[model samples]
Target: MTDIDHELEVKAVAALSDGPFKCGTVAIVGRPNVGKSTLLNHILGMKLAITSRKAQTTRHRLLGIHTTDDTQYLFVDTPGFQQKHLNALNKGLNKTVTQVLTEVDVVLFVIEPMKLGDADRKVLQLLSDKTPTILVVNKLDLMGDKGNILPLIQDFDLEFPFSEIVPVSAKKSLNLDELLKSIRTYLPEQEAIYSEDELTDKNERFLAAELVREKIFRLLGDEIPYSVAVEVEKFEVVGKLRRIFCAIIVDKDSQKPMLIGKNGEKLKQISTEARQDMEKLFGGKVYLETWVKVKGGWADDARALKSLGY
Candidate 1:
């Protein structure tokens, strides 16, 4: 991995014989738009979690594994605990957030620096008392006065009994080594559950769909993103190239034309961008096809949500 920290590589490599191999799952969670996915992607040195500027862009919990010579970290990037819309989709996403809380060895309670409000508090309340948690104060690079970080930490410390508090900037890769070291300290000594080379638990098909959804979130306006979901219809590989067909699911028929755009240009851009991302992630060529389909009120329908693997 190009983004691998040299210091971490040295420490991990040096510990191969003297140290016990460490491994465990970490839940990276926070309120909507708090940079949880960005942090996870940086930790893994790859973009396993799709990120967007929009709130609630991440709608699922995906595992990203980072293996070193002496430690293996399995990180779960969960959807932000949604609160505004109490629809089936939001409920399902919230369920996903709460469910993973009980399953991790440690929790990284991510928050934007100097901006812990009601949403952040609600998410923090869900952190189990039994699980060791680290208050990850992210976006440190954005702050003008770096010296004030300690006092900010002290302020947050009074709010919860955190095992540790780390300030980092996931965007600039600032203090990431410190964050990784903090994570290593909490992981238990055990054998690696996954192969050393494995990156994530999600299959290619699942990730392909997410890639499309990510493009929709990245390229489209605010209103259409929440109303969209992606489904990979067919994934066929012949020799070295992948031939993939996908369906873009929308909550209403009116959104379809907008998504497709005049002369199908918008749809083509989405497909091309998503396919390029898939190729990079998969390390192979991809032939992609996309079409938008109206699935009316799927966000509020439990049955439809379940079928779509919500």
Candidate 2:
């Protein structure tokens, strides 16, 4: 090849290699049971956050990182914004939602299709007009006619001047690629904050605790799950094996029998299911031990909440 042609080829290669990379935090905010955690799990292709049918199942702000070829999407799944029953616990959760909104580069305001209620509107008011917010209409599978979404999209547009509106069914994994593409346009050009292999910022102990809590939310009665909290007191690793000890904290002594059940069957089921999930997530044998403890008013007490890692 001629010297001039060789020099041109080298410049072209350098330009392609040094293309701009986009990386920034994206907050997923919505009311309870609108499928925020499900979207995060589907987008990352792993269960980084716990989910259930019950409201207020997600309490913490979890950072789920997704890295593409040239972009690193750090998705923060915040707790559902609570309007009623504002106790100390729910107040803390609401604060988490608002705090996440202010910090993120893009906000995905997820809602159910054709059902924007007072609760959804309350959460919408928390969003900033300045931020590049996307109206993510989740649960499209629930809609009988797909054509109905256009009017719903128009209704949401009146509520906020969204940068983009993408309809998707997170549970069905529909139109997620389009949602990702829409979000990519708003992300700032920067280097990745976390490695590509890293899926979440939470440690194994925190994930272990969340898995146990998920079992409680799924298996137990509605009231019991709301009043319960799981804590991983001890987590020891021994060469592809995890030995975990967890304490299930209840608000009152009367609630203990409901959790332990006759012949300890209820607690046993919770432990078994939690162990199975931990094994799947950690890719190791998990020896889990659980016990019920009564900690009265722990949910409402700020000191107790702080101690419990709330």
Candidate 3:
């Protein structure tokens, strides 16, 4: 066994004493598109996190809870780790990841099948000092052989002492039982941190805003995906229908041209698609409206991110 592996085994065994039989928070950390959100959703058996083909779509730390007769596991989905960007949005994403690490019972170090690099190394370097980390290799379905997976394991081993290394396909629902078992084996048992009825810490308004943001990601593709943010300007329940209004905040006026398209066709399409998703989530009809606004360089400004509750 590598030194890190041995160290992890020892650490996991030791942490068992911190609690009797219940588990609390487990933070999922990895680079973007590594399926951290997918895993959390699959484990929760619902869509608690917004996911798309684009990177950094998840701007905040989303918590999904799993409960059984005997235990509860609160899983946190965080923004993917990336190099520090000049944009305030990117900085806020990085800050969210670091802050989650501080309070987690265990850290799931998610790695995609693609070759691990300096970004992956940076995660190991950060976790080396805090929490007993479980190296969770996600997206196994995309890979064909042990050869593709072996290097990631070795690279991680070379970097830090991870408590456990387990491969899983969050999208395909593969090997998740083993992953959960391994995670639970290490977490100190504690009272359910949240109520049994609560599936996530995010309220209805936050979920509604994210639903709208996910729609934007789906319709706009790459160019506008990173440049946009969604805010719920109005969310009120009138009888059975929920009336909601949100602004699709963009970084430049040029994006408004693209988002609206010819004769407002694109905006109409986005609103239609977003309204359907919101209706399902709200369990009632949703009257949705999208207004476009450009805030130049909001990406680099901390004040902007904080204002958006980043």
CA displacement after TM-score superposition, residue 123 of candidate 1 (Å): 0.5
Superposed Cα deviation of residue 250, candidate 2 (Å): 0.4
RMSD of each: 4.6, 5.8, 8.0
**lDDT tens per residue, model 1, 148-174:** 887888888888889999889999999
Task: Show where candidate 1 strays beyond 4 Å.
Answer: 1-17, 223-225
Record all residue pairs in model 1 with backbone atoms less than 3 Å apart, i.e. clashing. Answer: none
Please provide, for model 2 over 152-192, each residue's C-alpha lDDT reduced to its tens digit, 9 standing for 90 to 100: 78877788899999889998999999999899889998666
The top-ranked prediction according to lDDT is 2
Stretches of candidate 2 off by over 4 Å are 1-19, 223-225
lDDT of 3 by residue, 245-293 (tens): 8888888877898888889998889888878877776678988888888
Cα-based lDDT at residue 282, candidate 3: 62
Estimate the TM-score for candidate 2.
Answer: 0.93
Window of ten residues with lowest summed lDDT in model 3: 10-19
lDDT score for candidate 2 against the true structure? 0.89
On the 0 to 100 scale, the lDDT of residue 204 in model 1 is 94
**Residue 261 in model 3: lDDT:** 84
Where in model 3 is the C-alpha error above 4 Å?
1-20, 146-155
